[model samples]
Target: MPETTYSSDASGQGTNGSRFNRIAMALFGRQRDKLQDPFYLLLLLGFISQGFFWENTVVPIMLAALWFLLIHLSSRKYAINETTEILFLLLALLISIHFGRTAFMRSLSFGNGLLVLQAMRMLRPLTPREKCLSAGIAIVNIAVGSQMMLEYGFILVLAAALVLILQTFHKLEAESCGFHESKFSPRAKWKEFSFVVLAMIIFFLVFPRYRALSSVTTNLSIGRNAPIAPTLDPASGGMEGTGRLIFQISGDDIGYLKTFTLDTFDGTRWAAGKHASAFKRNLRVEPKPELKYRKAIVKEIALLGGSLPADGYPVALKGNFFQDDYVSWQGSIRVSRYWPADNNIYEYWTDLNKHLDADSRETASCLKHPELSDRAKKMIADTTAAAAGEYNKARALEKHLRDTFTYELGTYDLNRLNPLDDFLFNEKRGHCERFASALVLLFRQMGIPSRIAIGFVPVEKNEIGGFFNIRDTHAHAWVEAYLPDRGWLVFDATPVSDRVLQRPASGFALTMRDWVEFIWYQKIVGFTSNDQVMLYKFTAEGIDVAAEKVSRNSGIMILLTILLLALTGGIVIFRRYSAGKAGRSSSITYSEIFAEHFYRDLLRELASAGIRRVPSETPGEILRRASIKIPSAASEITFITDEFCKIRYGGRKPEEDLHDKVKSSLHAVKSAIKSRKTFATDLH
Candidate 1:
């Protein structure tokens, strides 16, 4: 039986016999001592997650991580001499070059090229510089991802990568200066980390954001779903679809673009009724839909404020024209002044739910109206009598109207005194307005409070825009009946035209993917100088008011604090520099640099003992192989390798005496090798 002795490599791999074990160890690693293997794992995880989150394919990152892991953990397993080693290096170089070419082309927008560079740099036998380079690559990768990532999950990924990357940089910092530690304490590392993070935040916040780069990159129409925000209330049916593109609305929650509501119908026309509350300018809608709301960035050509077209209930409004905008009690957004007719851009947030649901319905009995003709009254009576519930009555009325009347866009006989009566009995045809108006009247006759809502039914979806496209012709009218506890419930009595197409609401999967997507893009990358100015103005008002109240001495205190911080930072740097001065005698030897020297000497000494070391075998593996011939030196070899690896790769500096201790152990191994050869000669 061959007695085998094992040792650890600085890169965290151990010796294993046979080709399979060698490959396995190299690929997975046996590193329980250092963070290199774990950091690589975390780095690979970031790559995989980002690849999946971004449009980049995960398979390439997967393969790259596998290759890097194999090389990283096994670099010490093979020396520069072997043919296998040569082939591995050659193949790695070719793949890296290929990645460099492809990743550079794709990385600026949304590619995993920097990750490949990071993996390449992390492969074993790393200098402090290479590790720092890899860490920098990680930071760059995160910054790039933030620009394109829409999902909220990216925050978690960023948090993890930030932690791992900081640790990696911290390890490198320790390796660089651990020879004589003056003050690289935990507090100092945290301060450095805080400064790095603070600097990034300052750069992001202080810089005037221009759309030059993001405008081109952000509008990337590649493999993207409808990003903006998720809808809270979605319906199965809407008005007949049309595609003239009156408004290009970007948001997760958009269905019907309601312009205004009409509570008064005079048979001649439906008009907006007076309310107890007048229109008022406000910052945000109180009692907003929990967290579910749409931040719609609307780009409307030839649209302005008599009644601003808002999708759902307007929660908040922001734009040049919207500063003086007033929202009516009936959910009408209107600006007191004229807005630009062309290329008008504005942003607003609206409630996600189209209808407020508190649950439980209340029914109203049919009421007699003297103004309505007998024929009109008869139809309303029949609709109320046949229907059971409030919703069923509405549904029955809808079905009756849809079945009886043909949807015609052309004008009907409106010269008559009672146009509602004429449309129901004689003409039996009109557009959405006529149908909706009659339905509202009929519902009112049934003692149900109802109103006419004017808006464009978003049946026309633009796939290119990933949002509903609203045109002038897509303007629709629908009736909303009041239900107790459950607020206004929408009921469309207009017949569905074949021209009407249904736009599917975003699925749960897509909803999750675009959860915070539009908000993030708009608030971050899509934020313009105008937005910055608005933010600054809003912030400065409070700051200026506070400054007025602040004592003059308080300002001086703040200045002094800044100066004090700078002085402390300077002192820390000076102490760090002074630690390496000539007058000071350090206790640490930095023996890691001499690890290869001792390793090479061991290989030479073993070769002289009639056991030639192979390039394919690492120092640990060579010692194990030689221990079979000279088993007496097995413990001494393991001890020496342990000390060497801990100092070289583990970022643990060696004490002054530790170098002498390793040399003494190496001498014992040489003596054992000499005795083994002598015993072999005596046996011969």
Candidate 2:
């Protein structure tokens, strides 16, 4: 207070501190210069890739265009202003509304809303926080994809996405450290990252999983414009002849892919009553009927209908989300919920040749139908008149329809009062639906329990994959008649010539793609908890069998062990003999000779002094400790020990003259130890 004088030194120090603070801020503080980093583009591409799995094409296309524009803007260093932000926000709002409206109009589901949000987030320049958000969204997208489609291609994509995401974080850390170069090489970083991915896979496999209760009820409508339940409505328009792929079937033999069977014919449309309940109840309580089963794997490539398609008489099904959605009864399965459009893999154990004795209730349900027209009644009576038993009667009706009717598409009488009657009497040339409907009604009227089954007939087997590639064009209807002793036997009244038409052969590339997809579905996607248990049991049984065999051949095993030990000893002795011969030659180094002789001489001296070196203790360590008891020869002991250590561990090649010096040092130490032992004996 008295002087109040500022020093030039203090002022200079203050100025320097302010400059350092500014530099630190420039390095570590949040950057506001760039709109977004180039690494974020990898995240954008990953997000865009997931859209291909969805049915929405417009959203993905728009998002892709927007992303390209953003990348262009970022490359040109175009800064986003308030106007740009507002425009992007408005565009996002419009897209959301359009998506919501389209989803509502078409009755389509809006799955995890991340895809839309990711697209919107990509529109603006991202800060560090926003980049982190984008990375998280990309990770979630990969996780969602794994659940939807567990293909090997998808797994590869997921791995790439993870690497890109990690690289982005690594770049962020570099930027924070004020370094333009990466801390680690890309190859090195990825090698370390591979372990992390391996750990994640291990956790996924070993962690216990529980089925989450699904809250969303899928619309069980057959198709976009089709009925809720499968109907044999001959009044409906002709079959969809599009050759678009619907599903794939992998098994030994292909057959009719049966979904639902309709029993009640209400004069116009054939419908199943309480079909969902019937299937669920039958599967829950009933023992799988005594029938031989052939296992098949089915994968939905495109959405065909609401219910899951399978061969007739599915004994069991393996899938992910819709395990409880389906019910099985009377050689048919009815799904209560709609299937996802992509990667819905299911394994079916079906009785391809089902033989069952139907209960009274099932027989009655199949026989019950609406009032039949006199024309229909007369036709049924005539067809089954000459036939003896129910089986023969069903076969007779099936043969009559096949022989009399000709297959024609888009020839249905929509306005007719009785579609089946029109098909049988007037229009003898109709699709499989008409023929199947006629045969089913005829069997019912003849006191034979029968139902019409609606599903695809997998006739086109891929030569490369050895599996059937079912298409929408293959959607067919057939009859299943209940006999006296045997169960419901599949009776397709559709003409064999029409049903057995040759399908267009698949190209090599397409066939190979299908083969890869089939392997993925069978080995990876189809592996369930039951399969895991089976694998565990199989491994344990193998171990037990191996142990039992070893025990049974105990004498042989002991002889083998002895022979192995003898061979190993002989090899060691041969190596030592070879080394000895090499040493006897003048080519042996001085260090090697000194190291061997010095170690053996030191051990012998220590033993004479009644202080033998233990096996666990090294020569150098023993000499150092022994020096305390025999201090007079400490210097010589230290020199010899150092020489041995250099030769043995340090790989040092001493001069030939140094070998003589080491020998002299060992001699002095041995004489000192012998003199000490003699003095001790004289005192005793």
Candidate 3:
């Protein structure tokens, strides 16, 4: 029924600005000086401005800051206040410019800019408008930087920037009416801090992420010129291995990296090798089990972010890599196009079956040759015929080569005429490339469609993500001889030398980096609609129908989701109702309730009467003082105040009559203030 009249004594506009200057200087770890508060506030404002808005206006603001710094520097010599602000602003501008354009350099620049801006504000603070500008720019930097290169490292920089922003601008009001201590009061400080943290968390969790970066981005051709004619050597870019180590594949068995399949073999080499036109064409291969202990190590290959091997080929064997409409086998998994650089991880599987197959034996012997001498050729023919029907002739050849030749790497210059001849006749030793090639030719001479395959065997494995690290040094050549029923049987002719598969010390770090790179590529850069579907499927776990429905874009799933949400809501509502019914009612009397109303009215009356109570003041004291000022309402006000105190302190019952009386008393107090014209005159 009554509006409370409020008043407060005109409190002196405290020199809060000076106190802020001292506190800000203390926080920035700078020596106390006249300019410190201004500088610190500038830095704080810069951060706020950057985080909230990133417009060209920031440039002018920065320029103004610079001009101020310059003036301060000219006037004050060697003072921390002046020098630091200049340095911070200059550094921030430099970092912003540096990372503003280039992709690789952007993260560093953006992070530095935040630090510089914050430091600058700390050194020479700005208006609230400027603080907002800085905070806006910070948001732009953080949002863009995360999309470009989101790493845990960037997270750390963001946290630091947030802290700097708080220290610089938290106490400075938008009005810039020389800082106020109440603004930094512990309660307010904590409240602001909590709000900032909550905002950052929401930004982090809900912000939509960009496509995953390419795993192959790590192997980006950073401005390197293409070679005129690359050689087949690992050192050359042609048949050369990727200098960047692809993640390793390892288990109990080693696996080979599949390059493009050469179906068309020329007399001297396996050439263009056209794809077997018909999908049903099966080239038979088989290896006897009795000769060797068996274990098929199937490698699950995820093509990370790099161009598919130079030749576009689907990368995995049928029944092993994937079963999908798009996949087709050409002797090997091959794609007609290179994998895109938008880092994608394509899953492929390969069976690593251990076997000393017939083809393997023949490969060892032939690889030991230049172009099999007449004697060597005859030996191969005889071995092939002796074990013709069902026995193993390849094994015999393998035994002979093992007994005679030694394993060696890098004996002959590749440019030399008939390099294989040099290895076979003069050197009598060579690495897998020379050996595998020779063996393949020898096997072909004996009527086997054996050919040389080049790629690295995975050597070391990363523990964190189980990635195989296939290095340039791991580049190897092996043989694949066609068998009758099983298709092409794989065989390695390289002698198992301890040094051959040396795991470099840097391999572990490189592997870990590759795994991270892989994540970036598949999740960000190479994320296709297909990948999204797969991710949804995987998240759905192994429910095939669910996966199929998801892949097919079945809207039935949406209905299911809605049903699930409704059921969950119904359950929650039921639980709340059931809990409420279990004797959970709450009740309070009228006098007890009136105490709250009386307290608020008393505060307003005192404020109008030119003696506003501080936020922390108690009710009894205000009532006692109000009674002294206006004796006419003293008894009534004291009765209300005493009852309010009793209800609050002693949990006394609040009555309806008491509540009505308190209301009447509050109206009378307001009328008294107005009659004396206390509400109208003091504020003026």
Against the reference, the lDDT scores of all candidates come to 0.57, 0.63, 0.48
Which candidate comes out best when scored by TM-score? 2
* Per-prediction TM-score to the true structure, in the order listed: 0.40, 0.52, 0.48
How displaced is residue 319 in candidate 1, in Å? 11
Tens digit of per-residue lDDT, candidate 2, span 51-156: 5434345655665666555544443344556565456555644654555433332222222355555555555556555666777766765554344344466676
Best-matching candidate per lDDT? 2
Q: What is the per-residue lDDT of model 3 for residues 508-598, given as tens digits with 9 covering 90 to 100?
A: 6766786675544444433444345545667667688667878687587778889999999999999889766652343334444667777
Which portions of model 3 miss their true places by more than 4 Å? 1-137, 150-152, 161-208, 212-254, 261-373, 382-386, 389-391, 394-404, 413-422, 497-499, 504-599, 602-684
Rank by lDDT (best first): 2, 1, 3
Pick by TM-score: 1 or 2, better one: 2
Ranking by TM-score: 2, 3, 1
